[model samples]
Target: MTTLIVLPLLWRTRAPFTSLLCITVAGFVYLATDGPGQPLPYSPLVAIFTVAAQGGLRQRRFAIGLGLPLIAVSVAIRTNTAREYLFAFFLFTMVYVLGVLARTRQAYTEAVELRAAELEKARQAEAERAVERERARIAREMHDILSHAVSLMIVQAEAGPLVVRSDPERAEAAFDAIAGAGRDAMVQLRRMLGVLKDEPSAAGEPSTSRSPQPTLAGLEDLVGEVRRTGLPVTLAVEGRPRPLAPDVQVTVYRVVQEALTNVLRHAGATTVSVRLTWTPDDRLTVSVENDAADVPGPRVRPGPDTGGGRGLVGIRERAAAHGGTAAAGPGPGGRGYRVAVDLPVVVSSPTEVRR
Candidate 1:
């Protein structure tokens, strides 16, 4: 009979409720038949513990319902004393409570591990997004720098040979402009490449020793360089001047640069007008308009062979980055091309401005 009661415990993990029922019945038979004296009921306790630890709500309730009566009867069969009944009840209750604690601890551990895995996955996704954004930013900067430089060089190159035999000094100036543009492009490209280098500086930060970004003050130089191409260009700035963040300045400069490059490459214009209007509402509006050239070439968009479509797209991106807007279309009366951008000026503190 004792062997019968012990045998059902083998299925405790796989079929805990069935194991507990079998053990309970065998135990009742053991007690009723007046079997050999045993100090405690071991197999029933083990089966009840397994059911409480591994079984669901219904199975656990069944275990408890059946265990209470089985424990009472076993204790009553063993000794008709209050102390023995109390002790047996306390032992079974303690085992059930322990099994419940083990189950809760297992659930908590699994939950923590699952939460940690989710957080790690999210962190990796964010890291990949950051890399993609950085690549896009670098692509835009490269496009702006290269397009403006190449446009100026092309204009100067086309005119250099035409005037070389007839006008030596003008040809010399054209050659000089080409050289200047090439050198400027090279410098900018070198600076860009330097950012990718893994060499750390003395402060353990990436090396960032490069020239300062172009500002509104450099617009005069820009206009003069384009004027050397024999295309009449005018710049007009209105309203009170105010400080702007470095990023805002770069956005403004690139917008104007791309606009002028488009005028040179696409619009065969006689005269171009660049305007910077600072309104009283903390907004700056940039406008570039060109009149149709006296001898217009084939009407084609700029950078057709050299990634042209991105110019306007890039201008819009820059504007949108600063919570601004850009519009490009025909000038007044549809005479020529016009590009305009409106930017909200964000002033940064002195500490935020890089020297």
Candidate 2:
């Protein structure tokens, strides 16, 4: 229990290389000069443990080589018979392997921590990409809402001035149409913002600010709006209509909105038809076609901002995201333009009551 025996174990962690050299030299000197009754100490293994924990493969091997010679010297000086040498050799080997195991355990812990850090970094990168994509989707939605609302309001304003002096009744009706379209736009925009704020609920559904999402059920009101703008739009529904998932309904609504907006801007057609068909095989079909108007075939192309060429691309992307299909082009005989979208529906069990 002298200071030399206990003090080396304390320095093993703080200064391992120096501690190893000191313990080896002191143990050798003690065995060379001390009396036979005094025992060789177990303190040298403490230094070996520290070196193996801190050093790499080559350093641990070198520490082991440095340690074995001290063990041999102690055995040669202390042992008097062959049996004593064998017992000393076996004991030294067992202690050496214990230090190597300590080093292996340290290396394993570090490897695990490095892998965990890499996984966290990859997860953060994926989250960033998802946010960018969501921002782009919201931008597209705002563009569609504002462009459609503004066009209807502009048409009403242009007509109100022309009829205000001659017919007070018609003037009032035109102003009313503009006011209605503006109100609807405000409500829809607020509803979209609610979706951005409201997180998913416990039921695993997106709990938005509004209760019901726009669906084919609202097609009549949309047709009415276009008719007010002087375009006679007819609506027809086919097959047994069924309720769809909220997100799918939004996509369907936007597709029809964009298609009709294109009809007002590009096709100079006075008459248009909106059709919806539901199939037993879990698909909903939407078709919009316009009759050739005073303006001949498809008009001279305008930029993407007004003509809605990019909007049709967006429609296709929405449908494809849900494993659906969309087509757009002139109708048979090249008369009017037609846009058709087919979307897959998640069919619920018949036992569930219809909302």
Candidate 3:
């Protein structure tokens, strides 16, 4: 009797069928040994079988198949008098109904648990994606701010000597610009490091210094810095350059900066063109092209420490984070490299912007 009661609780396991069979056999044996003079005690073996069959079998069929035999056996042997037979029938019906209800309840509970687990997994995946996006944004910002500053310093450093011979006063101004550019670079680097600190720590202390923000206004200074490199870079705007969100402006500036840097490092081109176009539809597009060098020289291999090979990779990541695309390779003329990026002018809602 105890075994029959306990079997239903274990019906979720692999041996449910075995448990059902054992409980049924035990009930029949007890019936055979105990005479009818005593009460024909009922066993919940049929309920256990009904519940086990709920694992796969149809409830109506299982109840009829199992119930009829026990009923017929009790009637034939007189182990249960007619009055007791009706009472046992009522009792077993209630037991089977309760068993089915328990099975349904258990199934519902398991389904809820599984759904909760799936939702949790999806939330975690979304969080990881957001973190990756923020890292890319910070990287693009760092490249734009630092590259602009560095380009200016390089141009000023080169001009210092030329101006020194002609006008000492102008040479001193160039040196002052170099110092200012260095300070700006350090400030930008600090801001980037601060953003990166949000990442989970694996070891020591995190840096806390913040950097100044860069916007489209900074492009003028960037252009001036590049011209200092002795490469003639022209900046043209097709549509009115309107103020943009910090991130979008930063992305535009970085795309142009990286393209120009690649021109200086690889193409050895003397003349370069940069065009920024803004439309009423809130779209921003940037194009950078440089004339092929006079004599095609050997390509300069990027060194490990310089992170030189990752420029295109970095640019692509930046464009994608802003819901835009970047294309780079050979230009239509098949002589010079052309890097272009198209970014939507509209800012996504706060909800759309991943934390």
Candidate 4:
């Protein structure tokens, strides 16, 4: 009989209502058989606490209603004086308080656990986003390095013969520039591979670098090499130039590199102009223009917004990443193709402007 009242409590978590009902029925049976004159068993106390702790207010009330009546009957039949009834009522009240407190504590603990789980999920998502951004940056670096190197190399390779026949001295310089471009491209590729090697994968595997990233300072070497291809690419500067963040300068460098690569690969222009201007408001503006490619249609095409394209879309993404903007298309009067970019520079080095 005692087991019948308490055994149903095992279902309290999964089937709380059914467990409460079973406990109530067993309690009534115990009272009927034992008679109200007898002391109430400990089973009723356990059932009352379990129901109150496991259920909502409605369930707690139902269990309390059933138990209270039985408690009153037992006190009425067994007690000869008021003192016993008072003691029993005091004991029942304490147990009821204990159950309510336990329920509240349980709900609070569950709520905390739910919030913690949500925070962990959000943290993982943010980590994934950072990794994606880093990967995109690295991809742009490699594209600019390889595309510019290969395009210059191809042009010099083709022009090497003509220059050799007409002017031996210039021909040697062109060949040397081609070799330099090849070596530079190889060094950059190796550095990229090293970065990949250093980046530990999720599985804890290491990928396996030297050479600093390219910057605007390195453009002189680049322009000299491009000029070796028998093209007139002039550079101009306006406004005072300030030191920029390494990453910001890299973006500017790549925008120029990618744009020039487009000219070398697709544009049939002999004369191109590169311009750099610094605004009074902590910004750098870069533009490259060349006589239109002989081929019909635009030399550069639009790519997706996510970047990684060698076309105008990639330029837009790179600019937008740094809170900047870019535009590329046929120049005015249909005389040439032009690419222009505006990049923000939050950090500045010492004041210096190179002409």
Candidate 5:
């Protein structure tokens, strides 16, 4: 009766199967030598402590369950009477049950903590992606405003001397235009530098109302400035370019301007072509290709003082910021470098779409 009831408890308490077998062997020895009435009060207590130790270390419920009955059997053997044995068995079983319940509650708390840590990591990654998108939008805006101002300044600088001899009045007007362009460029440059230096979370005070946003509408003035540089640039529009976000328009214009600037400074090519196409699916493509210079020569290395090398890097950065991609390499026939950028058109709403 003792083995049948107590062994099952031992199994439940997750006692090592080998230790249970040894316990059985020891019980049989006591029965054979001193009979079933022999005192063994310590056996039940030992079993209880062993199971509690295993529960603390391994967090197994079975060890606690198996130890309970062994404790009862030990009390029954030591007390030497059925009435006292029953009383001790009841007392230990209640205590063992409470311990098991407490351990289970602790395990559940640990699992909840682990799950919370994982959720926090996921939330952080999402926030980083959002910040990257916003930074790119800001970069596109800065490029557009500054490039248009610089182009106009270049035009006014070239025209000021030509008109001075014929019409002094007009020449002074050109000089005034040059001064105004310089002030506008300085303001935009300061805004851009402030954004770069500010904390990531700080969206500083916005620029004042004086400097207007630049868009594709400003391309005419950009082409005129390139022409003033003595480079023949042909601008063509395949489809009616719809009104786009300030950032997108600026990105497209800068990509074309940077490519043409590269052609003028490095490529030494005569004729350049700039093409803009707007698709029905709200995508804009801009391409700039210049004719290859005669005679294949070794690649010219740009020095630290040169601005042409950094222009391409800046163009690529601008495109990437706007969720767009830019490619600039050798053109077809391996004759010249061609730069192209494809950007998605982002509009405000249904009303903006109709406009």
Candidate 6:
């Protein structure tokens, strides 16, 4: 009877329910036959523990139904004193509770591991999205810089030869404009590349020495550069001037830059107007409008080579990045084209406000 009860325990892990049933039946038979006494039923206790820890819900419930009666009978046959019976009962109950705790801990561990894996996956996805957004931003910046520069250069190059023989000074100025635009494009490209470089440059200086992003202060320089292309442009400001965050300034500058570039490439307008309005409601509105051309001159749509149709899209993206909105359509009275953006501004506290 002892051999039969003990031997079935080997199968506890692989077949916990069957092992428990065999051990329990042998224990009952051992008790009935008045088998040799033991301080405690070791095999039956181990089998019950294994079943509780490893068996499914229904299997564990069956073990519970069998365990109480087996413990009752074994204690009844082994001891008459209430103290001995209570002690035996306590041992069985403690072992069963320990098995239940082991099962709960294992389940909790698995659940925690699963949650950790899910969080890691979400983190990786967010990182990939951030990389994609950065790539798009860089592409937009490159397009704006090259498109504006190349457009100005093209206009100057086309007109330079026309006056080269008749007017030496005017032809020289146009050539100079072409050279200036090329040089400016190179400088801006270098600055952008510097930001991306991880190592020191050829001169041994770290590439972190890049220029700051363009802001409202550079608006005059930008307007003058385009004016050199023989296109008349004016700038106006309304309301109080105040400080703006660096990103907001960049958005404002890029919006105007793209708007002017589009005008030069496609509008054929004789004059352009750029206006900035700082409203009382803590908003900044940027407007770039070009008058209708008196006579249709050279005009080009953004073709495949010219990054066609992306200029307006880039403007809107820049505005949206700053929680702003962009609109482009015909100017007032449907005479010309206008690009406008509305941007929210951070209000300055009294202490931070300029006198």
What local distance difference test score does each model get?
0.83, 0.75, 0.66, 0.76, 0.63, 0.83
Report RMSD for candidate 3. Answer: 6.8
Give TM-scores for every candidate, taking all chains together and pairing residue i with residue i.
0.86, 0.75, 0.68, 0.80, 0.56, 0.90
Q: Order candidates by TM-score, high to low.
A: 6, 1, 4, 2, 3, 5
Residue 27 accuracy (lDDT) in model 3: 62
Q: For candidate 3, lDDT tens digit of each residue in 204-281?
A: 555443444555666677776667555688888887555566777767767777877676555357678888877788
In model 4, which runs have C-alpha deviations exceeding 4 angstroms? 1-40, 65-70, 80-86, 199-210, 293-309, 348-353
Q: Which number leads on TM-score? A: 6
Q: Total clashes, candidate 4?
A: 4
Q: Which pairs clash (backbone N, Cα, C closer than 3 Å) in model 3? A: 191-211
Local lDDT at 142 for model 2: 83
Query: Which residue pairs show collisions in model 4?
Result: 194-208, 197-207, 197-208, 268-293
Clashes of each: 0, 0, 1, 4, 8, 1
What's model 5's overall lDDT? 0.63
**What is the alpha-carbon lDDT of model 2 when measured against the actual structure?**
0.75
lDDT of 1 by residue, 138-252 (tens): 8889998988888899888888888899999999998999899999999988877876775677999877677788777777788887888788899988886678888888888
Lowest summed lDDT across 10 adjacent residues in model 3 is found at: 346-355
The TM-score between candidate 5 and the true structure equals 0.56
Q: For model 6, how does the per-residue alpha-carbon lDDT over 124-219 read when each residue is reduced to its tens digit?
A: 999999999999999999988998898888888877878899999988998999899999999999888878875697898776666888877788
lDDT of 4 by residue, 216-239 (tens): 787776677777677778888788
Q: Write the per-residue lDDT of candidate 5 for residues 1-355, one digit (tens) a residue.
A: 3454255344535654334445545664565465555445444444444444335454335444655565556556556687877776675565555655665776788899988988888889989988987776565555555555665565566667877999898778777877876786788776667556653433565544344445677777767656654467888887755767777776776777667656544535767888887789888788999876753222122346545355667777877777878888888898777899888877742212110
lDDT of candidate 4 at residue 109, scale 0 to 100: 100
- Global fold similarity of model 2 (TM-score): 0.75
